[model samples]
Target: MNLNELLTDAVAGAINTLYGMRPSLDIIQLQKTRKDFEGNITLVTFPLLRISKKSPEETGANIGGYLKENTGIVSGFNCVKGFLNLIVSDAYYINFINNSFGNNFYGFKPPDTGAEKIMVEYSSPNTNKPLHLGHIRNNLLGNSLCRILEANGKHVIKTNIVNDRGIHICKSMLAWQKWGNGQTPESSGKKGDHLVGDFYVKFDLEYKKQISELVAGGMQEEAAGREAPIMKEAQEMLRKWESRDSQVLELWEMMNQWVYSGFDVTYKRLGVGFDKIYYESDTYIIGRDTVLEGLKKGVFYQRPDSSVWVDLTKDGLDEKILLRSDGTSVYMTQDIGTAQIRQTDFSPDKMVYVVGNEQNYHFKVLALILDKLGYSWAKGLYHMSYGMVELPEGKMKSREGTVVDADDLMDDMIDTAKAMADELGKLEGLTGLEKEDTYRIIGLGALKYFILKVDPVKNMVFDPRESIDFNGNTGPFIQYTYARIRSVLRKASDAGIMFGEKIPERINIGNKEKSILAILYDFPSVVAEAGNNFSPALIANYIYDLVKEYNQFYHDFSIIKESDGNLRNFRLMLSDMVGTVIKNGMGLLGIEVPERM
Candidate 1:
């Protein structure tokens, strides 16, 4: 047992012995002692005060005296304001490390011991635009969440739903059809998604110009926007797409292929993939039919204009439309269809939608409507809402100068990594190919770490320069620390020093060494907590703190150079475990730790 469980049982007996009561869990609250206190575990005596019928100090002294005498691990005790602090013996920490020496992935739970199937949907990108900085955050958060759940032993399925058919997509297609001699990705020498995205911006500019002319001719702004020639053509294209017109279908298929081709390159570069992908064009039919079925069953109501909607006023939400008057399905319709199909396919215990915070109400309506339609699994749907990620001002921006493309941001990060690595001579003693791969790892690591380190619910500004720094709470810093540990292990291996099958005997450990053990012991709990709360920031920051502690331990002690053979070997074992934990912990965040820098 760990320190908490060991002390909890001992403290519970003390409460019964002193007060003649079987102590409840709440009454025997045990936690890590405060940093200011000279102990490893602290027991709150205030809870026991009610049963002891004494003052806080008197109650603490009563329990502290009992624990010091009876608990072998409790070497000494100090009491302050009824908080009983127990200084655990050094042998406890040494035993903990030795027990953990052989398990490479010490913190992760076994698969058979955790939750069942879970489906996580993220990177739900539209075909009209390339993934931008915001989608990068979504992809990273979702990817990390999947890994975190797996570490907790949950069977996770990573999925994405592509929004391939909409007025926005039609806008790009219409612009391309009107503007030029047919240009493709091969001809333009640009990424297919970028090429398609360029036309999306072009469509907006022309549509705006037409609206301005109509407004100058005395039309109201809203009316002019509605009547804009380009707008009308895009709407017609959408109508044709829904009906699957041969010409429109041909163009749609060609354009979306270009976008998908581009998305593949970006997804590969960003190191994210989906187990399955859904498309709106296919699922919209399912959603439209489902909504119509709901209307017929009276679960939803039909408006006079023939549109369908669900009434959620009783649930404290407004009415939500499932289909437009012209028979075009709304986003909600496609979502309903997507959920139905996913449920039929996976039968997952939970469905997590990792999208931006802007769509909070949309998901709420989705679950409520699905429940109203008698789909029992609707309650398991969760929205992993996150805020937007913006580049520092004057940095890279999209073609419209508002969004930042994933491809461009990654390029900048890798370039920044190369420049910094070269300047510091960190890339010395490596070949041309090794240097290239290391730079990619460091750059992507910096990017993923900087973004994942922030809480998912908060807006963040990503500065490429700030992220690539070799020191501080950054990816490269942790990566470098891990490399440092690996270097120590390699030298020991070269010197023919290795631990055997038997657990090492308890040796003298100093304050720094003890601190490292204490931090290392919390790894499993940290992974569990991160998985339970769906917060990767927890794992990210936890690894950073552990790295910081080990770095301090390294600077203050001797390992291979220690004069005593036992102490030196123990330190080597400690270093090896630290390295293993670092690698395993970072894996939960979907990060790779290079063996060398």
Candidate 2:
């Protein structure tokens, strides 16, 4: 029932008859007519000129004549230069729009059969700190991607691989230990993760001071800094904790719980939760064993220092270390183990790693290693690489302590939303808690929309000042549109304005209404494309475009007019359907469509 499909078939048939040869065309895009153009849906005749051996005008005339002769669907046709412009009947547009009402939300249709199962791993946060804007992007993308895939009838497993154990975590432990007061989140009145994060920051400061003193004391001429007292002490603690030193192990477990607890709150707020969680503590040894097996099978090389590596020179890269000299598993090694574990657990048809673009080479190396290890499933592994989230000022550097904390960013957004709501006198009818919830929904909607608006491969700036505007291409605009629709629906319900019709197939299309209908008709194709491309931005862009078109239609036409029962009822149904699509699309992007924002 796709209008483009019907149009393409008709155009291709006409072209074939006109030229005595079949023409190739799939999507005959219906574009808006410009001032010079007599009709929309222009068919460029330049490609046909060589075959037709005629001038551009002659070719266009032949094609336009053939289309008019062969098809009843096209209302009229005009030839201008090399362009054959076809005008589709208003009746056809009306039929297409009316028939779309009963389709699934967002015009989505489930896959016919044999859909592949996919596992998407994203929002892999470290337990040493709380979530930040970077994690927000990951969460939204991952969560929305899952929705998109599901809409396309693919089975999707949304997972998170928590980097819970590392030398960095040991530093926080060291700080808490030497500082001596065993403080819980409750006792310290600090958020669990932030409390742990405070210790992490404390560790860095003290460790720096300790390193400076060591250098002043002329410890090994400052070349062996990692071997200094502070760093070495942190490393020693890591070893002890790994060996399950009773007190150290207990503290590590406790602090990790604190961080995870804090993360749960943030995840709930963001409206994204993982289906499964993988821990480095559990997978590192599995990676070690996998590497050892690879070494035995001659897939990897071991150095005299007892480190294992893969010579990726064949794959246009240097030898990547799979294991450290101390017999510890490296990042790549743990990844291998995680992949194997996931394959065993789910046996998914596709495994998507939603990591940042800086690790593009790393993922390439991983695919090579997996293939070398003789896993056929390795070929199906995909790297969903996204660019780093930069602030309006510049890139965030974690080492420089300039990275934005995820929880803090969320708080700031919420505060901004509340202020805006207060200024508009919008929260006056709501209770304090209801007001808080409203702000949270609007704030998070803005954050998710901003992140998902940009294509994944392109770097985006987080402009705190204007990213959440209600008047333009922003989350608030979409939310307000949905709210307006909801309000209309409520009013209809209260006024007993039934949408019932003897013939539910009637569509009365104005110019603006037809434009909105065209966009609405494209939702299925948009969702499918987004899923295929692994870009939630596609859905985000589609929804924004949909709502924009709807707004234009809303301004140009009245849906609530007391007179003209058929037209008003049809328009109300159209608005309601559009509202459903918007809500569904926003939901896929991990955004809330507030009913009364």
Specify the highest-TM-score model's number.
1
TM-score against native, each model: 0.96, 0.94
Residues 439-544 of candidate 2: C-alpha lDDT, one tens digit per residue: 9988888878888989999988887777756568888889999989988888888988987352244444566666666677678888889988988888888888
lDDT string for model 1 (293-411, tens) is 99999999999999888999999999888889998899999999999999999999999999999899998999999999999999999999998776677434554486766898889
lDDT of each: 0.87, 0.81
- How large is the C-alpha RMSD of every model relative to the true structure? 1.9, 2.4
TM-score between model 1 and native: 0.96
* lDDT measured at residue 457 in model 1 versus the true structure, 0 to 100: 93
Query: How many residue pairs clash in model 1?
Result: 0
